[model samples]
Target chain A: MLTLDRHTYEAIVTHARRDHPDEACGIVAGSVGSDRPQRFVPMANAERSPTFYRFDPREQLALWREMDDRDEEPVVIYHSHTATEAYPSRTDVKYAAEPGAHYVLVSTRDPQEVEFRSYRITEGVVAEEEVQVVSALP
Target chain B: MAIEVRIPTILRPHTGGEKAVEGEGATLDELLADLDVRHPGLRARVVEEKGGTNQLRRFVNVYLDDEDVRFLGGLSTPVADGATVTILPAVAGGAGGVAGG
Candidate 1:
């Protein structure tokens, strides 16, 4: 199960909504070995396509370096699906290089309702997990 | 000249879990070839053979110092002694061809 504080949850939802009709992507970083996510980093979708998303190569380098410098890892790798359900698509599964991260998928298909879910995509197998939203992290 | 190649977490298995490995070469291509000699299969993950020519994979981000190799000369990017080469898998994905989005 993936546990997220209310603020972080809201931040992810808001970013997804703000980029509706196009895919939005980002990562939540936390101390290495800490499953808890403490930083929200929204990234530019270089593809900027409604059906595709990619982090700018240069930005990706900087992001990885920052995480390394802080002794952190990507606890949560997230993206939005403007028209589909909150699930990993084939494209998503194929590019899941971080076998240790919680792959979060948010859907803004319904402006009134947001579908938030998490999964572990490892070695071509994707297993969905429960998302527990708490008022704050312990 | 010896270049220090920083391996990402996903590719650590090929490096025997060593985060950084030393390689020798004046160009990126030669460096990868040398890496594969020590860490078998490491080169295959980052470089692909296309139409009888070897090239870096599109999704693997390789940076020489702080500059992305793609913006430089790609596999032919020149490398100097003591340069830091970091490899990162791009964080990317989206709807597939048949998936509605």
Candidate 2:
């Protein structure tokens, strides 16, 4: 249901790759009245090191509160794949709590070979969705 | 015919660190069954429980050659020769230091 422009998508990919080996995670927040989807705000993965990444619960709670204050929905959640390809781990499936939010992944093993994909994660199944990356803003 | 099944990074430890392995089957079910034979407990990881209308976990996504399997027929989806299937997890961003600011 959300649209991502090419520039914004590329920006996410670059950030994910820049933090290669360690996962990079961030949020995409949009104005409540905006016609198009939200813009990506890349952030450092505090729980991530060069080899591992664990989502920081404190940060996640803070983001939820901030978005609530702004009256804007936290549209999408994004993370990077360091040494591995852009794919979900069993742990990821077990922990996905958001049903409405779109989950995005960026593979950083080969910067030039960046892969961007999105999904809707539920109790135990990951449902894939089509992401439209346009050149111009709507 | 024999087809190569690619394992994602998370499942690599169970697959002996092999990225891709061989499986024989005419359909996805058969292929997965053979995969289970090679690597035990893999099917359980991919599919949590059978008989449910929706098989995949909400956070896990599977793609065949860049196309999502959900849009297709799901587990019943067919795989051809040399096709690459990727299983990806749904990722969300953390709150601090750069996001939601």
Candidate 3:
């Protein structure tokens, strides 16, 4: 149900690797026209944590505002699995309040072996889907 | 032999700001008990309930080396000598705003 081009996926993998050992978080914004259901604008996460990440709400709001200015909405919310697989954790499923938003997981433990997976997590059920990233913004 | 456990940022407050600590235990439970002796309230925060059936909060994640504890037999997983354990939390962006400002 979600498609991310190759380039976008690589970018996320790079970010996740760079933040190795620590959880890296971000957002993806895009316009959902009739032709394409997904578009993305990735943003960095700036929060201090020992064993968890907390997305800066203010930064997210600003991003949303910017997307609104551009007539687009935030389509996805993403983060990394530092030493884990690209699967949704129990907490991830429980906190996924936005049903419309795609949940992306980037595994950074093995950057060269990076895996990008998508999910529609709700009420502890995470339904994964394949995604394709494109060359240019769509 | 004793093993070293890496303390995550959230639990740093309890561990007296030490990023990693040493414990004398052959299993994960023994190591955690040893850690609790030095840093009280840590076991309660990391392990939820009395029986350790569930993890504390959803945000917290524990890993032995690069493997997640949830998928690696939960807390009962064995720990070898000098193995490294890491903990991380789930952070995501939503309808909220910046971190500090």
Best by lDDT: 1
- Candidate 3 local distance difference test against the native: 0.65
Clashing pairs in 1: none
Per-residue accuracy of model 1 over A15-80 as CA lDDT, tens digit each: 999998999999999999999999999999998888889899889888888999999999999999
* Model 2 misplaced stretches (Cα beyond 4 Å): A31-36, B1-101
* Minimal lDDT window, size 10, model 2 chain B: B92-101
Candidate 2 to truth, TM: 0.53
Please give the CA lDDT of all the candidate structures.
0.92, 0.65, 0.65
Task: Compute the lDDT of residue A19 as modeled in candidate 3.
Answer: 73
Highest DockQ: which candidate? 1
Candidate 1, after superposition: displacement of residue B8 in Å? 0.5
Tens-digit per-residue lDDT, A38-65, candidate 3: 4445555555442355664444445544
User: For every candidate structure, what is the RMSD over all alpha carbons to the true structure, in angstroms?
Assistant: 2.2, 17.2, 16.1
lDDT score for candidate 1 against the true structure: 0.92
Worst 10 residues of 3 chain A by lDDT: A32-41
Candidate 3's docking class is incorrect
Sorted into a CAPRI-style docking class, model 1 comes out as medium
